[model samples]
Target chain A: MRARERILGRLRATALPHPPEPPEVASWYAGRQRNETRPQQIERLRSALEAARAEVHDARDAAWPAIVKGLAEAKGVRRLLAGSGSPDAARLAQALPAGIELVCFDRPIDDWRDELFDTIDAGLSRAKGAIAETGSLILWPDAHEPRTVSLVPPIHFVLVDVGTLHPDFHTAMQAGRWAENLPTNALLVSGPSKTADIQQTLAYGAHGPRELIVLLIDEEGAGK
Target chain B: MSQPINFHPVESFKERGRSVVNDPAQRKNFRSAMDFLQGKRRAQFPERQELEGLRDLASAIRRYSLAQLPTLLEQLERNLTANGIQVHWAENAEDANAIALDIARRVQARKIIKGKSMVSEEVDFNHRMQEAGIEALESDMGEYIVQLAGEAPSHIIMPAIHKTKQQIAQLFSEKVPGVPYSEDVDTLIQVGRQVLRRKFAEADIGLSGVNFAVAETGSLCLVENEGNGRMCTTVPKVHIAITGIEKVVAKLEHVPPLYSVLTRSATGQAVTTYFNIITRPRQPGEKDGPEEVHLILLDNGRTQAYADAQLRATLQCIRCGACMNHCPVYARIGGHAYGTTYPGPIGAIISPHLRGLDQTYPLAFASTLCGACTEVCPVRIPITELLVRLRNEAQARPDSEDATLRGSGAGRTKLATAVWRGWSLVYSRLGLYRMTSWSMSRGRALSPIDQGAWTRSRTPLVPAPKRLRDLLRKRRK
Candidate 1:
């Protein structure tokens, strides 16, 4: 017999009597955030992100490229990688400081995975939104901005607009209703790659980005 | 008396557990690791009411999922198929391993990089792959450490928790191509990174374990801190996800509470660094992600657990490792001592069903029924009650009236059954109770000093001078 039939058959044969209706789940937190105003949400998100060891910069709009450049310089990164066709990518390309090398995702990662894994010092991508409750960045990596742009590089740089912050993951998922139109992959990244495996010593950059630098776009003067 | 030391299939849990408890280093390691994890979980769920609400909600979600498991699994298969992904089913561990090996051979994969999958460990996947001459490397740092030491993961989340940092440093310095005897945490991580990076780039196939399989969207959710899961699923040409059938949920929203409690319970993190929601294989214009994605659902003995209403609670586990973290017996014995892929409280219950009760009698007996695991369980599995039930099942005769249970246990030694039976009979009779109490009190000095396994690590037990009934009667007089 086919494995599927046999397994499912056993499950059904041994199945216990269950209620006809599936039980209801508590979908929302009663008061996940004390205040839900745009600025307060941003403030809460920044602190939460910072607590997870992610560096959140208070610059947005036209100043994004300059802040990203400054971060790259601070990290001693010679090459900066980003996905193609995003407005953020265009702006970054235009304001490139002559010294650093910038590579955009035009070809398939299959063609350049080794180089991306080995030499790419930083990967900058745009965050679709931010979850304030857990301090996570929601990135719906698509054709233009592949998943590797946020994953492969040693330092992962994300562009987060303060207004896009949601009080918690549930609130964000509800508003997005991602089931209607979901990307191939959606990532909720709270911080840099880390491991507490060896004696709970807590080391960063085990297999992903060593550092996570967030360019928090405070378009609403939320910066304290 | 001459029994060769057998190790592979986890022979004799009592022997292994005794050795673990005897080692001061293992005891100290477990103490610090469990304390750190427990503290993180305590801090994560500070608000008592909120934490309870979440736990209740998580438990309800799991209950509802198990209730609708068959329908949801069918839905998941349909959705995944429609999303250009192949879904296969395995009836047992050998079947699952065979399917993987067949796929590997067909894909002509010489090198494979695997993310941390406890399920894979259950199937002994790496060994099977190596026997087929395929190099399957573990990408998770903890898993890699255990793999390097040629040992199984002692803890589920922190696989290398049994080993100290100095041991890890020595292993890395000796095993890794270019590394000194550096005890620095960062330097050690770098050494692992330098070695695993090449493997990730060169691997032909990526193997992962799904945390949650969303039936609503046919997406596989993987939660990780190291990002190796993402790499294993993205950098490779083909990605294979192996999961037990019970991992599916009805809707995407069901994930939030479960995910919330799972992270807080497992490692005390508010949320893991990365939560990858993979809906499909790479699209036509997509520049990254696996070209092919396959999810293999293994039933093994899970269906048997689901068949019985009382035993169905075993399927609700999300592999959070919270039960083990809080279990007093597990805290002292450690994961390796259990002699199974899963150790600790959850293991004590599930190992019987998965490995069969006859083979896992020692595992079932390796518990104190402390109820700490039940109290801390996010899904609120009545772990202590389950342990007691398993004990009864274990002691049951094969042809007994109660042996009708699908996963009903048998094979308790005749000696043990007689001892317990004799004690029970004597206690229930007033005549026997009085006679035995008087005799035991008078013969206290002549009590047996060697209490077998009980006295191995603990002081031997002897009767007190007076029984409660006798003392009360004397007071009344």
Candidate 2:
């Protein structure tokens, strides 16, 4: 353990008691001052939401059909779960074969059991907002929304309303402040749940859905 | 003899990528997993303006931190030492690896559990540890998958973006013999959780990557979705955090912006599921933690980049993987194709510099220069510009055909070559340029051919309506 001690010794030599100055923090808080007004901030938020929504819709429309086809080909996908606020989730569910089932939930439910939802082939939810920078979707836990609605199902279909997309991450947090009290649990998902734990080989859907289908919906385009 | 873990960077990358891409079932699994995450992220934050603000704040913080990195690192080092945490400096990959290996050997540690430190990946610490006969086990789910497959990560956030559930089922069936073949994700997670818990408890040393190293408090921050990192750090007798020198921020105040941005940029969460801040090992009154804490500050060519005025900006990267997620090239080919510890657009630029141009020349040519990576970079590293710079560097090699063709005095055989050379000569001398301009203006009456190769695929340049000299003369009249 001589090597450990030496490494530790070096560490000990470099340690100090407190952090550096507060300029960086002050600058950051100061920067927020420019867009401090609620109306101005809301307008910015609205535009950003519109842009994000449009992008999400475009991505979803391009990828959804292929995802649906792929899911249709899977072995055990009879019943699917869908959330409210999804643009085409209802329509898509209606379009499924007569024998298949679609269960819709308005919000998260604490009493929901994993096994009940686990048997389903897929779960569908509407994204509250999407971060374009990381391709992540944010989800909040609520009374009607069972946590397993997104996690237990092997296949997950997410509906992204084009109106609620953000280009970067900081904006997402700023929006979070608008919520009086944030939900107890929140999820930010980038890609399919995966692991490269075994000899550094990738395996998808390790503890969550194995398949992901994002449907970006442009409601205005329906009229077009 | 144990099979030699060959480190053929290129061939191995291709082989790994080919397997991942070819697996249709794996792709299905990835699609489903990403969909779930996307759904969750959306539900958490329904407003778009908030995310944008977070991004801006995050970018600003990273830029500020990078500007004062040298100072911040010194402060962090001092603070950490005062807190009874040992810190070491590694100038390069070899030094970093040697230092870590020496620590393991000193402890007579045969089993080491790692908790998702990407810096260790940069130095290929696992290979070094195995070479030294120390069993290195990855406790994180993603790292464990990579470890089991003998492959590297394809995505920084989700290392196994390319693998599917069926493939994992097959792998689990083979590796964990008693585990039944079940496509259920929960069952698989239970199995992994059980297996890793044992590994965590048994490991002699725990290694982790630092998310943020606060200079003010000498605290190392780790953010994770699972509690694995916490377990690995707290359960082991010794804890070692390996991180890049640039991870340091001057004070605790700089941390909020970074934390805000890192979470949103990484997964679009207001905050990660777990954010653990450890100031030092277990103190006198502390109940549980490692007996000793060690932090390794790895330069590994970062200082070289830091010294170069043009390259120093790159040190601002926070490893958020935003550029990778948005990059078209990375989306198609994945991370392994970059053939480096770091992958994606950032990797394309930084890897060659760190590994040497000769070893990583191909990576420089990997990008389409789409500029998307730069637009999304939390720290605004000018990734696309760096990629182009790397390309120019690659072209400068003596063996490059472009170099031979572009080099002076090569040949005047081709008409295009002669014209190019003549143009260059004329441009070099101001007197010659004036004469050429006069002649060109005089010859404007003659129609020029549209056959110039440069104009073939683009809009032909419009002849100057009139020379500046002509314009001046007309004005006098």
Candidate 3:
């Protein structure tokens, strides 16, 4: 506390005679040209996500469960983890093939830390929204949807509601009013975890999910 | 505990630079990596007009934030506390390390999984943790590789940029158990993933660096491509974030532009794989995320930089390492040659404030005053100008009334001062300048064959046979 006081006090003492006026950030930001229609936004999002090596599938809202089931079976995934209370998880459980099992994150991490880290082949979560310009998934992790669901597993399947997509980060934040109520952890995931650390050679799953598959819920069948 | 590569005399820094420059392999490695990074950055900013607009907006945001730094810091602390995240303050490196060590002791932590935090490097956090008998492991792939080799990061963004794949494979095979020699980057990364995963799950604490702390949202923003940052910050029971106080911005809206500029400048990505914005600890009924979140705002001579308006520009850096990538000096000597936590142009300007001018004055003079750094700076820091100011501060009169830097006038010498004064007199007077140039041209043959360090790589610096002014006069006639 004393350190804080001293540091702040010293800073105050050295304050400029007149604080500089804040820049017109909003006006400047508004001058940029980014007014794409919904389809164009989704197209931009798909291209950017695909460029980052993320698999983006265009699926109807009612058909995503079957798609997830097919993807899981194709990848030979046996154990899939999802949020216990998520309706999408329930739908996935009913749609999964008999050989695959759906596990819910109902227990505290302390109870299933080892299993989550070593046993789960894939994890599922729902992205709150996405940024089309960067193809980033905006994740607001909370009590119902834990943060690790998309991070710990080798494979992660995220459900993105196409209606929630925004043109860019600035638009997303302002439209979502993120500053009014930020969650404990808000994440923007663009692709599968990767690194160029070793001799500048890019490699995926350096510490996070090796694969990120985005299931776009195009209810209107707007995306081809 | 072992100290960081200590600040040595200017001669040793020069010697290290000389050795690295002479090593063709090392020079080639740096040259290729820099070229790759520069090309990627250029590709990202395809439109020069938009890039300039973004740069202007980014610079204004940083300047305004620094101007209102004190208020924003207080707001950040207040809001973070309200949000159940504890906040601690440190005035120097020792204070910062002690605060983190105290937390580790309180938690009875045996191991700490760390994301890349250059503040931790600045405060010598790992060595101090080692002294306290705790293993603060580096979880980032590049950091882990560098840590395994017991060396400092050569580049801010690419920690292991100095080593080749074959070299890394050899290091891993020798250091990591049950690992075979393989130069494949994928295999090496897989090996690292296996080792670090266990450490992340088992470690008692997670430590990270904050890229930007939003005062309005009470959030700590981290920018990274790897999932290790998320794993380290989320997996461990206790999460600790350390950042220089200058990282704070007033609102969340300022983040996107700066984030865009930062990623594009640092690694040529539109966005990293993960951008984590952590506001508080795990809320009620939350199944995961750290239960206890602590933020340490370390001053460590930042207040010194803030005292002066001109030097204050040094604090505007976002640690993108773009200047280093663009620096010809850094490309030749590499980051290790600077012998500071930060290297290149940014390091040269900021180190004087961090570790007094007496120790870092040499760094200020190491540059060629090329504006490449200033040209490429996303926030337009005017790095070359800062370097010149630092050089002046290092050589100012010790007892002068206006001396604002620690170790001011350390570079001053009776002979150098006298020579500079005489130089000013000769150059400022037209007649004296003409007379001196005329005599120097006539006496060119009498000049020394070996002109000290100048002749080390090239021929002697003998005066030209004729003065430039005389040649111009002849051409005019």
Q: Can you tell me which runs of candidate 2 are displaced by over 4 Å?
A: A1-224, B1-52, B397-477
DockQ of every candidate: 0.76, 0.04, 0.86
TM-score of each: 0.95, 0.60, 0.97
lDDT by residue (B140-171, candidate 3, tens digit) is 99989988888889898999999999999999
* Maximum-TM-score candidate: 3
Docking class of 1: medium
What lDDT score belongs to each candidate, Candidate 1 first?
A: 0.86, 0.63, 0.92
Residue A118 accuracy (lDDT) in model 3: 92
Stretch of 10 with least lDDT, candidate 1 chain B:
B1-10
The clash count for each model shown is 1, 96, 0
Cα interface RMSD of each candidate: 1.5, 11.4, 0.9
Off by over 4 Å in 1: A20-27, A30-33, A222-224, B1-11, B404-411, B424-446, B454-477
Q: Is candidate 1 or candidate 2 better by lDDT?
A: 1
At residue B463, candidate 3 shows an lDDT of: 84
**After best superposition, candidate 2 residue B356: deviation in angstroms?**
1.3
Model 2 lDDT tens row, B1-477? 123232434346555545656766654544444444445445545666656565665666665666666566777888789878888888777888788788888888889998888888888888888888888888778677667777777667777666666776777777875988877666666678668756766788999999888776787877775556766676667788999887887555556567766666666655543455677676542323576788998866665555555666677788887777676656656666667778877776666557665566556556678787777666667887877666665555355543321121221136645676798999999999998888777777563557475475676554575799889999999
